[model samples]
Structures are given as C-alpha cells and as structure tokens.
Target chain A: MCLKPQHYEDILRDQPDIGWFEVHAENYLGAGGAPLHYLETIRERYPLSIHGVGLSIGSADGLDTNHLERVAKLVERFEPESFSEHLAWSTHDNHFYSDLLPVPYNQHTEDLVCNHIDQVQTRLRRPMLLENPANYLELNDTVTSESNFINNVVQRTGCGLLLDVNNVYVSARNCHYNALDYMKSLPLQSVGEIHLAGHAVDDSIPDEALLIDAHDRAVSTAVWKLYDQLIQLTGARPTLIEWDTNIPAWQVLLNEMVKADLLLNQPPARLAHATEN
Target chain B: MPQKTDFHSRFAQALQDPQINTRPLLKPTGTANQRRRFDVYRNNRAVSLIDNLRSAYPAIFRLVGEDFFNAAARNYIDRHPPTGPVMAEYGGEFGDYMAAMPNTDSVPYLADIASLEWQRLQSYHSANSPVLNINELAKIDSAELVNLRLQRHPAFSAIQSRWPIGSIWTICTSDAESATSPAEVDMQRSESVVVTRPGLEVLTNVIPATGYLFLNALVQGKTIGDAAEPALTEDPTFDTGSHLAGLVALGVFSDINFTTE
Candidate 1:
C-alpha cells in the first residue's frame, strides 16, 4: 500500500479488518513529522512490517552500516512483527539505484544474498524474509534456478521467504518458466508471508512477455490464478496486498484486502471456486 | 567475496556510477533487455534522492519553481548521497553542495535557506531539555550573571544570510504569499534566523545580527560578559534585556549554571 499519512485515519475507521499495514521504511526515517506520527498511531492499532527497497541485499559491495543502523533503529522503535527486503541487488559499485533490480540467481549470488541476510538479521536481532524479484531477463544460464537460489538463502541464513505470487507470474512470463514449477521447487517450510501485487506487461517483449511488478493496478486474473496455486500448495500464510504506485481509493485497497482474506481462509471447495472463477 | 556489510552496500554502489560492471557479480546472461530493466532502477534511485532533497528543504524548493528545484535536486543527489543512512544527516552537506552549484549562482541565498531548513530538522530531532524558570534566574545576582555558563536546548539553531532570507524563507515555505521580486531583495542585505524547539514544535524566528553574535558566543561556552562584547560590536542598540527575556519566555535554555571561575 502507498499508505499515505492522510489516508491512515479513514482507512482504519472504514476498514478495521485490514489486519496490518506495511510501509516503505525510508519514508519514515525522518526525525518527526506527519508520516512518522501517523505510522506510530496506526501501529498502535495494527501490526506492521518494515519493508525495505534500498538495502540491495545481493550486491558484491559490502553492506552499508549507515543504512543498516537506520534499519536497526527503526526495528527497535517499532518492534515490528516482520521485516523484509527484496532479493534483487540495486547497486553497482558504491552507488544505490533505488529500484529493486533483479539479481542473477547463481551460487555466488546465492551465497552473497545469504551473507547479507545474516548481517541484516544480526543487526536487527530478528529474522527477515527475502522477497523474489520480478524478472525481465533470464538472468544466469550457469546459476541454479530461482527456486533453488531462494531455498539456498533460506537454508544458509535461516531466513524466511516472502514468496510474491505476482512475481512468480511476472518472472515466469518474462523468462517463460512455469509458475507452478517455480513454487514447487522452493522449500515450502521456509515460506512466511505471501505477497499479491500488480504487474505490468512489457509491451516491447515478444510472446506478449515480460511482466514488470509496478504494483499500480489491481492484481490481474493470471496472478490470482498463481496465488490460488501457491495457497493450495502451501495453505494459510499471511498475505499482503501491495499497491505502491497509482494508489486507488481506500475501497479499492479494501477490495484487495477482502481478496487476501478470501484466499487465506477460503476452504478447498471455495479455493476451487476462487481459482476456477 | 567480501563480507556482507548490510543491505545498503549494493544500493550505495548503484547510486554512485551507473557504468560500473555488475556482470561479474550477478548471474550470467539470465534474461533479455538487461539495460531496460536496469534503467527502471536507475530512474528510481534518482527520483528517491530528488524527493528527499525537496522534503529536506521545502522552502528552498518553493523559492525556485518546482521545475528548477527538481533539476537542482537531481544534480545534488547524483553528486552527493548520504554516506550514512540517516536521511536527516544525509542532506546536511546539501547547503554546501547548493552553494557550489554553478547554475545556482543566480540565487545566492538558496544555500543559506537549505542550511536553515537542515537546522530546523536538527532542532526537531535533537535531544529534548526542560525549560528553566525565570524565578530561578532571578536568584542570580550581578556576580552570578557575569559568571553564568548557560545550558542551551538541543534544538537551538542560528542561521545568518545576506538576502532578505528570513522573509524569503517564510514566504517560500508558507502559502500566505504568491510571487517574489528578486529586484526588491537587496543582495547586500543581511538577515539572521534562529530555529528553536522551545516546546513540542520547532519555530524559526528572525533574529538581529546582535542576537546572532550573542548566541554564537554563548554556543562557544563564553561568559555572559564575553558574549555581550561581540553582540555590542555588531549592534550598538543591542537590547540584551528584551532579547534575554524573550528567549527565557520561549524556553530556549535549561539551567543557567554559575561558576566562580
């Protein structure tokens, strides 16, 4: 969710069952203001997850102590139920690209990711879940599959996986991998939270391919199908409705929240109906 | 492979130089249009930094139009990112960066404005202190006044500028005014602003050159007599009683300690 400071009050009032609120950690790093104040207020009412976009966990360069310290400080203040970051490396040399650029899923990248996870968990004094990237390129021919790479990070660092179903669809479309196969390859025991967000189709790519996780619109029917598959494979995990850009009305978000609840508690018969329909 | 420092390692690198090769670091030839994908990231980093600069110095952005501010902010972000993650401290050097900007020579006061805004944030975040009462200060006689070593509130900041800076900063940050005439603002004119968090809110109050000098001396841990000298030199009409009373009423200081030495 874009989770604007202005919208928090009305959202809590109108939609009390929204469960939890997830926010970009960087937005609240300031000393004091409406953003921090509102987040603190909302946090009192609901659980929160500190999701980071700037960590660049898969890069070859060393972790940024300054950024880690900021993250650690926030974790201390909020004492959030969960904290998560992307699998993508967003830096080259020492500069940081703010976007979650996809990482090559090789053994080296895997090891690097695991090490980064260890540092974050150590600094935060808590476990963090690593989310998958929405791939545009196939990434590495020599490296292990995406599932294996994610599993490796989870195994080595004892971190949890924030399996984004929409990402599975986006990557599968981008690289022509089967979404079902991607889910099946992962060690399901490590799965913690589930993510459902919107993805845009890269019009330039062939085979109507290349889905970019823009999180601007409603979750597409195809992504919902993939979500059904994952939920059936691994039942009853906490799901988040992520809409970062082009945020719609609170009702629209509530609709997504409703969808999330449906999938989580939706029984097998209902799951079949939810998936089939 | 180097030890994992933290998540910001790669993000910091990504912001530095775009051409630096990540081929050795990432998985080989995994998909198509790596450049296109990377562009999305490059765009995001640039945008975040630009947005941060605006947030840090809203008044400065308002002085210049949004278009101009966006351009200046972009340039500053590329040249200097937070060497540390605390964004409050990230843009502290932005004042110098703005001053050095060749294009910004048109607006000489922009840097000072940025500095003032940065001070506002510093004042907002600084350690909180309780206000000392006037009754306690009344107990101090002439000898104690001469030897006082006052404690300043953490959220105390002083900014001096050559332009109608305080007025300009106020106009820029507030919605009360519309257009500003660059001609009306004399380049040689000087003004000082003091940002203090007396209570829960941080306030930016316009101060005279006298007060600026006086406060600077106090900041340096000077005796009350020593501080009065420079302030007197700066403004012969420097009204110490009025200013001191006003500051006391505003709760700008805590305990005013007196030492015999």
Candidate 2:
C-alpha cells in the first residue's frame, strides 16, 4: 500500500498483513518534518520500498545528480528492501514535468536509458528496478521494441524490472497493442516487483478508447486478469496495490491487498503451466 | 536514427505547448490519431501541477474558490514549470505570480495570504533541531549576555505584512460561518506573524510589531543587545525579559553562541 500521512495512524493501529509498504521517494526528501518522522516510525514495523516517480531516467541528457543524491541519502537512511524508478522521464532542460512521459524506443534511447540506470545503480551502490512507462504516444520507430529495450537495460546495467501491470494494460489499450502479448514479451525473470493500480478512460478521444493511468479507483477486472496471468507466469513476485488519486478507505485498500495476497499464495503446480508457452 | 536529444527536446516542447505539432516525431505504426493521444500528456502535466499547487495552497484555494485558483495556477505553471521533483518545493513563487495576475486588484491581500501559507509550509518542512533550553542562558556570564548571538530555530520564520494577513488566514481556514469577510478587514492595519514547528505541529502566532522586529533582527544574526535595541526603541515600555521568556517558550532559539572579546 502507498503510505499517506492520514492513513499512518490507522496502519499502525490495525497493522494490516501487507507484504511491504512503498513510498514515493520524492515525498521524503525534506530535511526534517512530520513526513520523515512518521515514515521512520512506520519503517520500524513494516518492510519499506522506495519507489521514485521523478527520477526522469529516460532523459537524454542523463540523471539529475542532485535528485540522485537525495534519493541515495534516503536509501542510506531507510535501507529499504527495494528501490525502483520508471522508464519514463519527467524532466527536460532543468524543467520538471509533473507526469511520467513516454520515451521513443530506439538504439540511441536504449543506450541512453542503460547509461542512466548504470549511474543510478552506481550512485546508490545497489540494484534498482526500472518500471515500464504508461505510454501515451509511440514516438519513434527503430531497431528496439519496448520489451527489448527494457531487457537490454536490465542486461547491461545488472538492474531489475518492476512490472507495473496497470501500466501494461493502459499502454496496450491506449497505444493499440495486445496487453497479453506485451506482458509475454517482457523478461519476467528480471521482474523483482509488480504494481497493480486503477486507470480511467479518457473521454476526450471518443473515437478511440484511451485508458489513462490515473490510479484513482480499484483495480479493473481486466487488469486483475492480466496481473493474475503475470503472477502465474512469474511465480508471484512482490506486488503493490497503488491508489494515488481518489484514495479509498483503509479497509477498502486492505481488501485489495488481501486479494493480491490470495493470488500470490496460489499453489505452484496450478500456475506452472503458465510458463510452458 | 534521430538523435535522442533532438527527439526529447521536441517532445518536451510539445508537452508544454499544445500548439507544437510533434506528429513528425512519431513512428508510422500507430493510428493516424496520434496527435489526440499525445495531448493526454499535456493535459496530465497541467492537471498534476495544478493539483500540487492546490495541495500546497488550500487556504488560497478556499479563499479564491476552485475555478479561479485553478485558472491562475495553470497560468503560473505554464510560466514557471517546476525545476525539481519535490512538490512541496514546487510553488514557492506562486504568491508573487498571483500578485501579478490580472483581475486580482480587488483582492490585493491575496498575495500576502499566500505568502503566509508558503511560510507555514516552509516551517513544516524545515530541518528539525533541538531548541536551546532556558537554563542554558542562565549558565552564561551576565556580562556576556549583551554579546550573545542566539540562533533562531531552523523551523522558525517571522513574516511582516501591511495588511492583516494573520487574521485573514485564520478566518479563511477556520469555521467560515462566523468568520469575518476579507473585505471587512482594516486595510491599513499591519500584521506580523511568527511561524514555528516546536514539535510535530506547525503553529502560526500573530505577534506585535516589536516582537517582529526583535525576531527579525535575531534571525539576521543580531546580538541580544542589538536585537532588543529595535524593540526598545519602538516602545519605551517594552519588557525584553517577558518577550524573551515568551519566545524561548515558543522554542524559537535553537542555539546561543557566546562571543568573548
């Protein structure tokens, strides 16, 4: 579950049986505040994962050393079990975009992403997972596919992949691709974590159904099916139910976690056939 | 192969300005409606930044109402895109931005109110440090008290404004039914406020002008004698002992450096 300040007390009071807690790294970058105070308290009880949404890893110019150092310090302070960022870039020429942006798949971009990931890993002195972005536009055509690009980055940087299943479903629907085929093409062995979130359909484009990754509601039935398929294939990596916008009641969010845990604890033999094809 | 930098530069330009046509940058495989799909990023970028502003300045949002604040926030965001990822640090310039916006002459105190909110946020996030105990000063030699340079706590800040901003902020944030309207506020009355986070909670206290001068001077590295001189000059009856005690109780001073001649 994504930790919010309002839910901190409830989390401590109930102590839900979650696998781990994930926090946006940018939120805790303050020098000192209640955010850090509460996070420290929560970290003592629950295993924490630092998920970065603003690293702009895909920027061609490269990683922001300042942000990278801030995140590195946070990692040093918390020593979270895992750290992850996105394949998307949110910054350009010193300006930060508040949204995760799509990057073109090509040899040049692939090399750029690999070099950036290498820097992050080197700076943090540990492996980090790169999440596939929710793409809004397919920018360029070249030698590398999205899956191949991610696989190449993992191969070159010795980093892991954070498979955000909602992103896959959103991208597949928005960009006109088969969600199952896209998931199948990913290097599941490299997936260290998985994310399940809600998305909304953008009514602006009436002709074509464009699913925006809004993260507002419960996980959709179709995305849950895709997640189930992925977990069955990958043998249940650590999963997170992310609800950033329109956050539900704590019990409701816990219900989603219960659902994820149920699928995660499924019998191995029953899901073994998923890897056959 | 197109240079990655070239493609990213164009993409960034398009993300900021919807007028920029980036259809040439895309692959031919996707549907012909790539432009409409691409506009999604632009919309998300604006909406998310506006949301950040709204979160940071809820009092301003409540004061101006949602539609006006959103319109102003969108304009400010386009002009001043955030340079970093931290949303808390995103809208520091928004108060000044709002002040310069059109049709805001009617609510001139809006900027000062926004400034007060900004200070509250800064105090909430500033570094936490141990405050100097009252007994610490007792240990210092009486003769050395004049030259003692007391450092303000990291999370402490004093704001002085011509309009009654502190009361305006209180009215806007508290129970609205009994609150006085901003228009009824005395435009000529000046207000000063001290913001500090002694513990986990951030407290904003309205103070006299004398207190503001003393605290402002002390924050600027003035010695005890030098800092107290202004408040004394402003009011002959100013009781430095009581004021010092009150400020200490508020956990304003974090350290006292005794300089020996």
Candidate 3:
C-alpha cells in the first residue's frame, strides 16, 4: 500500500502484515520534511523499496543528470532493498509531461534505454528494475517487438525487470494483442518483482474497448489471472499492489495485498496445474 | 519515415495542443485506430496535471469552486508546463498566473491567499533544523550581545499582505466558525503572518508589522540591536525584550553567530 501521512498512525498502531512498503522516489526528493520523517520512522520497521516515476529513462534526449543525482541521493539516504523505474519517458527538452508516454520499440530506442540504465546503475552503484509500460498507441514504424526490446535491455545491462501484470493487460487490451502471449514471451527469469494494480476502461471509443492504467479501482479479474499465470512461471517474487489514484481505505488496500500473498504462497504443484490449463 | 526525435516532438506537440494532427507521425498500423489511442494519452496528460494542481492548492480550489478552478488550471497548465517531475513544486507560479487572469479581477485577494498557501507548503517541506533556545543565548557573552547575528529557521517565512490573508486562510481551511460571506472580511486591514515549523507541525502566527520588520531584518543577518531599530521606529511603543522573547519562544531562529566587528 502507498504510504500517506494521514495513515501513518494507523499503520504504526496496527502494523499490518505486509511484506514491504514502496514509495515514489520523486516524492521524497525534498531536503527534509514530514514525508521524510515518516519514511524514516517507517523504514525502521518495514523494508522499503524506491519506485521512480520521473526518471524518464526512455527519453531519446538522454537522461536528466540532475534527476539522476536526486535519485542517487534518495537511494543513499533510504538504502531501499529494491529500486525500480519505468520504461516510458515523461520528460523532454527539460519539460516534464506528468505521464508515462509511449516510445517506439526499435534499435534506436533500445540503445537509448540501455545507455540510460547503465548510467543509473553506475551512479547508484546498484542494479535497478525496468517496468513494462502500459502503452496506448503503437508506433507504425516500430521495428522491434516489446518483449524483444525488454529482453535486449536486460541482456545488455544485466538489470532486472519489474513485471507489471496490470500494465500488460492494459496495453494488450488497448493495442489489440494477446495479454498471455505477451506475458509468456517476456524474460521472466530476470524479473525481480511483480506489480499488480487496477485499471479503468476508456469508454470514449464506440466500437473498441480501451483499458487505461488508472490505478483507481480494484485489480481487474483479467489482471489477476495474468498475475497468477506470471507467478506460476516465475514463482513468488517481491510483489507490490499499487493504488495511487482514488486510494481506498488502508484496510481495503491491505485486503488486496492479502489476496496477492495468498497467490504467492500457493504450492508449486498447484500453480503448475493451474498454468497447464 | 520520421526519426525518433521527430516523432516525439510531434507527439508532444499534439499533447499540448489537441488541434494539432498527429496522424502523419504514426506509421499507419493496419487494424487499430491511432487517433482514438492517441487521444487517451492526451486526456491522461491533461487530467493528471490538473489533478496535481488541485491537490497542491486545495484552499484555492475551494475558494474558486471546482468549475472555475478547473478552467483556470487547464489554461495555466497549457501555458506553463512543469519543468521538472516534482509535482509539489509545480504550481508555485499559480498565484501570479491567477492574479493576471481576467476572471480574477473581482477577487483580487485570491492571489494573496494563494501566496499564503504556497508559503505554508514551503514551510511544510523545508529542511529540518534544531531551533535556538534561551540556553543557547545564555551561553553567549553579554558583552557581545549587541553584535550577535541570528539565522532564521529553514522552514521560516513571513508574508505581508494588504488583505487579512491569515484570517482568510484560516476561514477557508478550517471547520471552525467564520463569517458567512466574503464581504465580512475587512480588506482595508493589512496583515502580516509568520510561518514556521519548529517541529513536524507547521504553525502560522499573525504578527504585528513590527514583528514582521524585526524578523525580516534578522533574516537578512542584521544584529539584534540593528534589527530592533526599524521595529522601534515603526512603533515607538515596541518593546524589544518582549518581542525578542516571543520570537525566540516561537522557534524562529536556528543559529546565533557572534560578529567580530
């Protein structure tokens, strides 16, 4: 569950049975404040993971050095168990777009992403995970497939992957591809973590259904299926159920985590049988 | 066959301006409709940015109501997009932008209220520091008291406004009893407020003009005696010892340095 100040006392009071906590790296970049204060207190009890949304790792213009330094500082301070960022870019020409944007999967894009990841790992002195993006539009001139692009980056940089099953489902449904095929094709062995979140269906289009990664509602049934499929293949990795928008009550979010834990704890034989059919 | 840069540039242009046609940039994929897919991204960009502004300026949102605030925020975002990824620091310029907006002419005090909210935000996020105490002053030599320089806390800010912004902010943000109408506010009364976070909780105190001048002078590295000059000149009845005691009690100073001169 995403940490908020209003829920801090409750979290400390109840101390829910959670595996770990994840925070957006950008939110804690301030010099000092309540956000840092609470995070420091919470870190003493629970293992922390730093998930970066503003790194813009996929920008063709190259990574922002200042932003990388800020992330490095945060990593140094928190020393989180895991650090991850998205494959999509949100910044260009020094302007932040406030959303993860799609990039054409091609050799040029692969080289840019690899070089950016190398810089981050070098500065941070730690390996980071790259998340699969929930894409809306597919570039017509795209030369490489999404799976091949991610696999190539992992092979070259030796970085781990954050398999966001919800993103896969959203991108697949919107782009008209088989979500299972996409999940099955990814380099699951290199996946160090799993992300489950909710998405909203865009009803703007009359004929087609477009699922936007809104992270507002409960995790969709289809995403949970994809997540179960992924866990069957990769086994239980560190899983985080993200709820950024329309954040539900702490108990409701905890219930989602409980659901993920049940799936993660499933026996291998049972998961194998489930995966078969 | 556009290059990656050309494609991104065109895509960003389309995101900023819905009127721009991005169909030429796409590769002409067979089945799926590109326009509908691209519009989702456009809508997401606008919605997310507007929501961020609303979160940062809740009091402003409440004051202007949702429809007007959303309209102004949409216009402000299109003109001044965020230069960095820090959403908390994104709308610092919103107050100035609102002041110049044509629709805000009747509500001139709106800008000052926005400024007060921004100061509160800055104070909330500023660096933590150990506040100065009376014991720290006692440790200093009495002979050097006149030449001592005091540093304001990192989370300290002073806002002077023509309108009673402190009361206005309190009324807008709190659930306590307040005047039923905006006309109840006395616009002729000028007010100064000092915001400081001695601990984790941010406190805003409406101070007299003398207090504002004294603190402002001290923040500018003026000595205690020098800082008191303006305050006393403005208000001949101002008591330096009492004012100093009150400010110190408020945890305004973070450090005290003795001057060699």
The residue-by-residue lDDT of candidate 3 on A154-234, one tens digit each, is 999999999999999988887779998898888888999988999988776577788889888899888888888888877
Q: How well is each residue in B2-94 modelled by candidate 1, as lDDT tens digits?
A: 754432454345335688554443445555456666555666667766767778889877777788778877777777654543455667777
Candidate 2 has an interface RMSD (Å) of 1.3
lDDT tens digits, residue span B19-89, model 2: 87787777777586778778788888888899889878878888788999999998899888899999989
Q: What local lDDT does model 3 show for residue B185? A: 71
Query: If both were scored by DockQ, which would come out higher, candidate 1 or candidate 2?
Result: 2
How much does candidate 1 score in TM-score? 0.80
TM-scores of all candidate predictions against the true structure: 0.80, 0.94, 0.94
Q: What's the CA RMSD of model 3 in angstroms?
A: 2.5
Candidate 3 segments whose C-alpha is farther than 4 A from its true place: A271-277, B1-5, B30-33, B138-147, B176-181, B259-261
How many angstroms is residue A104 displaced in model 2 relative to the true structure, after the best TM-score fit? Answer: 0.9
As for candidate 1, its interface RMSD to one decimal place is 5.1
Error of 1 at A113 (Å): 2.2
- At residue B91, candidate 3 shows an lDDT of 90
lDDT of each: 0.74, 0.86, 0.85
Quick one: ranking by TM-score, best first? 3, 2, 1
lDDT of 2 by residue, A104-197 (tens): 7888888888889888999899999999888877766445689988878888899999999999999888777899899888888899999999
Q: Which ten contiguous residues of candidate 2 chain B have the minimum total lDDT? A: B1-10
Of 2 and 3, the candidate ahead on DockQ is 2
